[model samples]
Target: MWFFGFSTTNPRNYWIIGAIILVIILTLILKHLAIYLEYSHKHNQEDDESERYKGSSKIDCSKCCSGAIRTYALEELKSATRDFRIRIGVGATSVVYLAELGDGQFGAVKRVMEEKGGSKKMFLDEVSVLLRISHPNLVGLLGFCLDKGEQLLLLEYVPNKSLFDRMHTRHGQSSGTLSWSSRLSIALDIARALDYLHSVADPAVIHRDVKSSNILLVNDNHAKLADFGLCKLGHDIQSAQTPTTIKGSLGYVDTCYLNTGLVSPKSDVYSFGVLLLELITGLKSVQGSTTLAEWTEECRKNKNVEVMVGMLDSKLKGDVNVQQLHVLIDVANLALLENCHGRPDMNYIVDRISSCMEPDIQPELPV
Candidate 1:
């Protein structure tokens, strides 16, 4: 048979055919050897990693993890999420989908995108933190799946959306404005949750990212802190400050943590202060012209109580109690103090906010 002008009758054609066969044989052999080596290397790496994971004290109790937290198969999660069809939330590192689990309960499945900040270390860190901590105001971890190159976290579905969207609603439209009491309640709820994390937890956790967007709301407008990917365990309260890469949103990052690489609960306190500012003024922590912190400082410097009052979200329609506004402003100012140590702790914050909720007392704005 003749192929590409090469015929068996010609000696040169025979040589050419022989060379083509030799090249094909060599290519097949090399490809097979490479595949075998890659497989062997991957198997060894996975074995070593598995051994390390088994010995890790951070997630030591496999029984607890398996029993307390459900581990869904990759195929199951895919089916529940409809191939990630219904996206409820998105962030730099992950995409969250609203899923209907087989058990008939709804869940928010946060799928880690490989190209984003979804490093193996971060994924495990988040899972480790979520596995141990449980509080009413903190988002509950229902389950997780880390198989078949997929990293997903199944969380309690909070229906009312985030505090950010509620507090910073666009235009003049009102989707049931958060009453002053509701705002205070949300603030107190978050404060207690943070206090639990900072003091009550065994090793303690620092919620490195404590922005308003991370605060989710239930149907009743109750606040629940979500997103634990940036959480870090503090060795102890006194020596909580540890050197690490700066991780947090702008406008809310503690200046001390930014300037010095040390991360402590105080860093969270600073961010909480910004959150308080957002709740009180109904302005973003970072405004277009300046930060909420800077704006508040300016108002404080000018001693202009009217300017401060005027800054309250117009959506309230003059319904905000003066006493509550004053208390919120005071708390926010303390939280926004330049010195991290000067910021009030979460317990103190919760106390002040709770006291503000009292019906009888009404404090006038200070001169």
Candidate 2:
């Protein structure tokens, strides 16, 4: 075949080569287009979920009267929080900024960012899990907003501080007193929340990330779970793993979590165990010759769990009986069980911890 250009060899050969090259280019283009579409879809879903949350909470005379949170409009949130003018806090997936509404009320607007992978799933999980559940010991979700891939969760502001700030490391062995009752109370609250997540919720929600940083403390020495309710679940319990893009805090994450990339309510218990250890030993979990797992193992092997428990703050030292401290130890130890299934269910944990708190106090709910 000859054109005005140079003489072409065989038309069939040229046609075959051109067709193959065209197919290769098309394949590459299609692959890229697939990726772009996936990303766009995720972005759009995130946007939709964020928008589902709007409006602010109004005072309800009914209910417990603890001032239940009402959803807030996105615009009302912007006005109340001064367009997020006061930067209160930030986390890996979200930011907490102070806000106010037209009613002249103060609140917090938690701005959540959809993470790199499986973000749509994570965002939806948070909204679904948090909005329906409310407990005195759990942070309240005022509302949420999703727009153009930006996700925002409005939460009730707890101003005191985090349990992490009160790390026993701050002061010496005297690290002040997280009184036995207070510590026990904190434990019970967390346990109850975990129990609710593990047993009560529809498919169940796992607080994949639990650490002292995630425990919000109030003025009355009350504690509640924070940074929780965002988790990854799957087809079944056998494969309930959250998308991995860094979960939980350093030193607090369960060792097994690294292996399976799956987190369950038990994982939260493991972290709570670390918190208990911190409460008892007055030491940062990471500041040791061995991983907390190894250290705890050594303690068990040496039959010196008492030696560790003896490190508890002396403030209420005499107030709590030996049996009580030991029980707390057992509770923490049970949560640390290497096998997730072997660990006590959160309901059992709540019962045991609540019982330990006031050996005089019995479980109020059916387990």
Candidate 3:
């Protein structure tokens, strides 16, 4: 039958099938393109961010490290410490692992790894700055490590824990453990260190993160300031100002600095004020219901500032002259004034506090 051979060819059906296949292939291609574009965009964004961060960062290294401190490489630290085997202490800037000095040396080593801001800059800054300064009350820098992105600092091992440990060790236990003379001595030492940092150093150092925890208690009830990660020099201070990041611990941080980002020499003064309060009250600078400052002020205003005097450690009771106590507390209160400018300079403040002390209160005794 010669009937409709054209129809039997069925060109329309072939066309429909081809169109369907084409549509499927196009859909898969579009899906792949979208994924590739998304991934590429994300990767590009990451690269951009990395470049931006790298450009703004500054890293300046000094000649070795301070005699107070020394530098070691990551490999050297690993070899000396056997990979930080003995975990001793930790600070806001790094983890202090205990290690042997080796080489027939009996001294212990504190292995500190740069953990915040930028590790390399901090490593360089610490070594550079510490190398330039020497002080009796500051911890001695032993050595440091710089490798890849990891940096380690070796410091003289201090056996005693931070002031945080002493202050909060089972309530009155801390205060009772030491004599009034000892506590006062600690304050004096800290004040003296702060004074030196502000006045004597070529460029004044502002211990931005001063607190009891940063104060290391060593042999004979002595206290020394440690950790310079957040520290800045007066000239090197940020130009933009305006409340930078809140870098300090809560209770010990200067309230005025927090509010204004004005980290001057007096910044340490505010923190010392809190420390003084901590010593006087034998209570933590920070406690529940209110801050240490608030509680002290509340009691200070409502009743005689002497109401909380009973909280002093038994070892300190009456050991400190009440008249001297009054003077010290007044100094602390003024140092903690909400107005940063109202605070006294560290040098003047130290001299004043020192003047207020008895002849015996010099290096012979503190508090």
Q: Give the number of the best model, judged by lDDT.
A: 1
lDDT of each: 0.77, 0.64, 0.66
1-367 per-residue lDDT for model 3 (tens digits): 2122323256676666677779999999999999989977865564354233222111112322223344556666665555555555566556665455533232234434444444666567767776666677887666666666676666655556677777665422534466666677788888888887887887878777788878888743578888777777656542446556666777877887777766677678888888888888777767885678887786544336456455455546556666667667778878889877778877776676677777775662222
Off by over 4 Å in 2: 1-74, 101-105, 114-121, 168-176, 233-246, 300-306, 313-320, 359-367
Q: At residue 186, give the lDDT of candidate 3.
A: 82
Output the number of the TM-score-best candidate.
1
Over 4 Å off in model 3, which ranges? 1-70, 102-118, 170-176, 236-243, 301-308, 311-318, 364-367
The TM-score, computed over Cα atoms with residue i paired to residue i, of candidate 3 is: 0.71
Report the number of backbone clashes for model 2. 16
Looking at model 1, the pairs that clash are: none
- The ten-residue window of minimal lDDT in model 3 covers 52-61
Per-model tally of clashing residue pairs: 0, 16, 17
In angstroms, how far off is 272's CA in candidate 2?
A: 2.2
Per-prediction TM-score, please?
Answer: 0.76, 0.68, 0.71
Superposition error at 63 for model 1 (Å): 14
Per-residue C-alpha lDDT of model 1 across residues 7-48, encoded as one tens digit per residue: 887777988888888999999999999998997786556435
Ranking by lDDT: 1, 3, 2
